[model samples]
Target: MRPLIGLDQVSVAFPGTLALDRVSLQVFPGDVLAVIGANGSGKTTLLTTLTGLRAPTGGTVVDADGPVRLRGPADALTRGVALVPQEPQLATSLPVWENLLIGHGGLRGAAPGRAARARARALVAEALPHVDPGTPAGQLRKADRAIVALLRAQSSRPKVLALDEPTAVLGDRGVEIVAEATSRLRAEGGAVVLVSHRLRDIVRLATRVAVLVDGRLVHDAPIGEVSVEELVETMAAGRPASAQVTARVTGERPSGGSAVPRAREHRLSVEVLAVRGLREHGLSVDELTVRAGEIVGLAGLAGSGRSRLCRLVAGASGGSAPVTFLGGPLPSDTRASRRAGIAYLPEDRANESVFAGLTVARNLEIADVVPAGLGTLFGPRPDRSRTARTISEFGIKTASHQTEITALSGGNQQRAVLARVLAHQPRLLVADEPTQGVDRTGRAAIHTMIRRFAESGGAVLVVSSEFEELQELADSLHVIRDGRVVARRPPDCEYRELVALATGARDEKEAEQ
Candidate 1:
């Protein structure tokens, strides 16, 4: 089969970094090519090069029909190519319908009229059955935002579609929708380029797989020819074994009695945090508890109330739920939550967690300000020694602490954010989608940190869309559906069983059997 698009020895260079070096790949009609690699292995750059967002410094991009030079995203769109970025670029303040329509409008030469608006509504109805088109984009959950971005891309009916981590934040139903859409596109002779960290997604959607190490394409094969273990080994080639941190179940007591003992140990294991009669965003929980020295995981599909529960517990949003921390009543406010030793790691790190315009040193110092009140009244200065230790401990890769947080990769940024939150050493950690964009190595580091914290006697309540992740990291998993936790399973529960429960494919009774 002739390739719809081909890259011939393409190379892209920045001032000090060689982003892509002599990389070549082909996208054929009706083919789904999966791109797999470690973070910063030029996967994003490859997509940008194909979409004309980044001009190749060397080599040519050839079309089966003729020679082609993509000037920019606009040019690529004209040639029937579309890209769905990892971070959604929607105008949050605008209505969902407007964002979807505007995305489609950019591809068409003619301005959208009343007829076009009607067509867009029909498309939205067909593509997104659960989403409300009239709702503001800001009001939608992160997973919903991703869905909107994908549906908008589908609206253009491009011959070639490129998706970056589309299933990273989506639930099982959302993944099914995307898979169906991809199959339809393939049947219609369109090509797909998928970049994802989830092996299950790769197994379900990809016909072929390409592995990139550093800046080179190290392996390429049909999906049927390679096992998941082989793919993991290929991606972990350069990453050291020590760098991959696994969760540990320790037997020794925490130093300095830092962790409160669990009730099973003959001592009263007090609940560090508790919520009762909580209600928000149409989701309600009768009661929830996080005991000291425990890691409790919330597992559910996207938009299934996990994020909302995190926000409510963190006091980032208003809810009628009565929350208590360490025997004290808690208020519905962020500052109070922190003052009460509750630390929150938001899901949308780009917008809610990090200070992108500031340096890593400054971002870390924000933790210091939380405890000192006005002690550093003149000007807040970061503790250099503490920052250096944190950078090393968290395995955050940066030129220096002075480097801008924005300049780091997704995994590094996540590490930095996590480091800052842990610096405070709060009693209760409320983390949502903690490893959403991190790669395999980075994920291990994060898992290590969370486990260490729990072992130290601190309590953790984590929410993750990946059932396997929860199974590995959590001591117990809570399955949520339609805004309520319907089942609680041991960490040894099966992934497919958990998914079935979360999606209402099976009832709790059936799951138990």
Candidate 2:
């Protein structure tokens, strides 16, 4: 079978770094090639070069027998290649079907005709009926939006399709939807390039696999030849021997200590997170206590007032409440909350968390940017050596301290962000969806890290929609519904019980009054 797209000794260089080194690779018709690697492994650069986003600084891109060229995205599309990014952008104001066919199948300088709309509707119905064709893009759930993006890309019927961490952020159902769509494309004679760190995806979807380590394609093998353990070891150790690969990324603090160093090390009990009139935001509960060294979880549906409760406890409140920290009234402002040994992790990491476009080392210094005593405005220049040590201390794998934080994998990014948050040495951490989107190993590591924080005499208040995660990580869970605390359960509560409490128990009189 002939290759649909090929890279012959392609090298791409950015300032101060060679993103891709004389890497030769190919995608054949009907192929599903899974790309696996640690962060900064140049997987993304490979995809960009393949899709014409980055020009190769050396060698050539080829087709079957000779050199091939791509002028831009339009040119790549014409040459049978398309890229679906990690977070697919859509025209939020438009209807789902219109968003799917927005930029394609239209007259030059005119809107998409009715036949195009009809075609998009039919295609979605036949292939992905789960996605509502007429719903506004802004209103669709995260998974539905992703499905729509996949359908839109396939709408063009390209010979070779490249996906960058497509299922990284999706749950089981979302992953299944994407995997099925990919299978359909492969069975229909199209080639697919899947970049993912999720081991299950590689095992279940890829026909073959390749591993990239430090900008080089180090391992290429048939999916049947590699065990999951071998793949993990290979990615973690580059060329594996007998060492435990899981230790490298599995939530061991860079500065190693016993797992429960100071078991249940409580400094003091903070009482009564009471906010007068917070009932306006569905915050019906007036009080809860989070003693130091405890992991207290807030579980509920998206609009269940958990966020409001978290914001109140984390000091993002508009007005001061009776909430006490270390036996004193907690401050109302975010800055004061930080100074008072509290840190808040926002739900949206892409926009609210990490400092984008900054190097890993610089992003680590963000917590210190808080102004204190009118002496330092952005903290000290951050001892360059100390920041570097912090990265090692967190086991954040990056090619260099100078590398952009965004270049790291989703897991590493979470670690870096958590490291930054911990920089404050806060007594309490208000974490929202602490392990979202990370691979299973990464997920476990993050959980361990959070648990370690609590074990070290720091308290944690976790807000999550992932009931399973709460079950695994929380010491105790508070279920919220319509802004009221309906049930409090142990960490091992039944899944149905938590779901029923959070979503069922609607009648106010029937709940905890």
The estimated TM-scores of all candidates read 0.59, 0.55
State in Å the error of residue 249, model 1.
11
TM-score of 1: 0.59
Local accuracy of candidate 2 as per-residue lDDT tens digits, 79-150: 878888777788998888887786674356566678878998887676557667777888876666777788
RMSD in angstroms, candidate 1? 8.1
Q: On residues 1-513, what C-alpha lDDT tens digit does candidate 1 reach at each position?
A: 777876889988875567788988889998889987654578888988988898899988877875589999988888888999977888899878777677455545567788867776676667667777777889888778888888778878889999987876566675697788799899899989988756667878899999887778888888999977677667656543321112223333333222222222211287998877766555667677888888889987654678878888787874243777887777568877887788899999999998989998888888877676765657566779989999999989999899999999888899899888888789999999998877666777787788778877789999886666676678778887767777888776555456556645566576553
For candidate 2, what is the TM-score? 0.55
Q: Judged by lDDT, which candidate is best?
A: 1
Model 2 scores a C-alpha lDDT of 0.73
lDDT of each: 0.77, 0.73
Q: Which stretches of candidate 2 lie over 4 Å from their true place?
A: 106-111, 125-132, 238-340, 343-513
